[model samples]
Target: MNLSPAERRAGITVAIFCIAAAALAFGLTLPLLGLLMERDGWSRSAIGLSSAMAPLAILMVSQFMPRLVARFGAKRVILIAALSDAVLLILLKITDDYYLWLPIRFLMGIAISALFVTSESWINEVTENHNRGRVMAIYNIMLSAGFASGPLILVVVGIEGWAPFAAGAIVMMLASLPMIFAKVADPPFEGTASFSVWRYFLVAPTLAGAMLLFAIVENGSTSLLAVYGVRNGLPEGEAVTLISAVVFGGMVMALPVGWLADRMDRIRLLVMLAFMTTAMAILIPWTIADPVWRLVVLFAWGAAASSIYTVAMALQGERFKGADLVTANAAFGTIYGIGSLAGPLVIGGAMDYDDPHGFAWTIIIICAGFLVFTVIRQSMKRG
Candidate 1:
């Protein structure tokens, strides 16, 4: 654990260069999420099933990630992820079949898992204990900014044919080239012990519960906003913006939330966010024809909700260490995955009311669920 000046500099450099590459996919993936879902004429079931594969895949694969990192090395896996991500974007642009999209999305999920795990693992290995929190905060900011950028790119590309997808792929390719030159190794895996995910959830129930609830709300929001748009008869391009607006809204507040995370009681902050988010969701269903107001409402929801991820992860960082840490990470990953799968399933299924404004009810239902969870967690006193 001690590092020379040269080593510290090198680690930070690698994180920056590689993270930028990975961030490209974040921006590209935004519009593509809508495009992919719509292109295939996917039922809510199909979108839920396909989208669920990412977190599911993460859970199944993370158990063996240490071994993978040990063998292929982190740099190689990241490069592979980048290359595959580029290819998948190309494939997504060309395909409109539901059947084909399932496998492609699953593979895209794999690529996403690889880059995220590798980026986090690499940083953990290089950073000092004193700096770990700060570095992670920085990384989260980068991811948020990168993710927010995706929608802006879509706005630029104007979302017809393969243009947006192609642009996304190009960004991924560009990110990969510089990292390919750096060729960093996988940082050492921190934890090795196995623990039940349920046990870890108990250790920090508020943070853990918040992670799960927000995952569904956030992922569901991201995945289905476009379809919600199309169902309401908005232009396809405009439909994609609904989701992006929310994400960009979230990004706008990410830095402030990170700053607050250092100052506030994260648990209390999360509880407040739960209330704010629920309010946003309730407003979603009523904004059908009000384009101006829809943006305002979703943006508010995004701003309030974005902090959940950072704070929850901090709770994890506080309570666990070693292999136990990784176990907790995987557990959170599982909860997030399950919630994500359920979001679209529940919302999409509830579309029994075809009224143009009924779409916002989905947000309302999701927000209400978050409210219930918040009350439960806040009221429960862990002895």
Candidate 2:
């Protein structure tokens, strides 16, 4: 896996592109996934259930990825995952019933997990410690791009039409070809299957806590803020913009945060991120005056929150390995899926009271998670 510097850069660039594309194509629709579910004759709760399956898929996928990578190679695993997701996304346009989509959504989750695991693993396996932070920063940036771009794709495709799914499918299909042609030496990160979920706290508590809390805050915010905005009296378009602002702002800031995370004390930096995000959530309901101010607040919120996922990953790289790493990711995925499930249900319920009510729930959740996280650090014996 010793690549020339130029080759390393190219490999990273390709990996970033593929991962971003994969995340963008699917992750973007999440904000409106529940709305889409309603259009097709389901409740927000049901939609949340389907969307929650994604995290569960991540949990299930990580448990098996060691063997999958061993048998299929990381590249092939990514290809199959991407291809499987593309097809399922296209099928969403064809089906209006939830019964069919439940399983479809479940499979889509698996596809995303497979794609992401392979995409990151490919680069992480090859990168030296010196360059890993920059590589991770770039990777996180691309993910932000994919997620933010999903709504824009909505503008062109409309939530009801087939066009968005087609575009998503095409992007995923195209993302795979680069790996097929590129020269890469496989450093399969394999290990004994023997491991426990609880062991993750021992291997990497910062990574574990960060992933759990961030999963709740990140996906919850992304998935529910649209409905939250509307409750606050924003026009449909502006409400949509708030979601985009958070994602784009988060994307722009993730790299700098990654750099700082790399250079400074990681736990302290993570604590800073938690406080920053919690503060932003606190500001949201209070600062809903002019549309411009609201957008700025949303942007700041995204910038602060997106770092949770990226930094948690960097922390994992900083400590855990092999089975421990996979288990941590799986546990994160499971908890994140649970968060995704709760977000829409709770937030959608908030919309019933009005938008600020939803924001209140979100704010409380953010603060509670961060506060709990801060206290948990006291008991953790750092690796």
Q: Please tell me which predicted candidate would have the highest TM-score against the true structure.
A: 2
Candidate 1 lDDT, tens digit per residue, 48-118? 56656566676556555445555676677777888898998789767856678667877877677677756
Model 2: CA > 4 A from native: 28-53, 59-61, 90-98, 157-164, 290-292, 322-324, 346-355, 375-383
Single out the weakest 10-residue window by summed lDDT for candidate 1. Answer: 183-192
RMSD of each: 4.6, 3.3
lDDT score at residue 275, model 1, on the 0-100 scale: 85
Q: Which run of 10 residues does model 2 get worst, by summed lDDT? A: 320-329
| RMSD value for candidate 2 | 3.3
Backbone clashes in model 1, listed as residue pairs? 27-150, 191-322, 191-323, 192-323, 284-360, 285-360
* C-alpha lDDT score of every prediction, in listed order: 0.68, 0.70
**TM-score of each candidate?**
0.74, 0.85
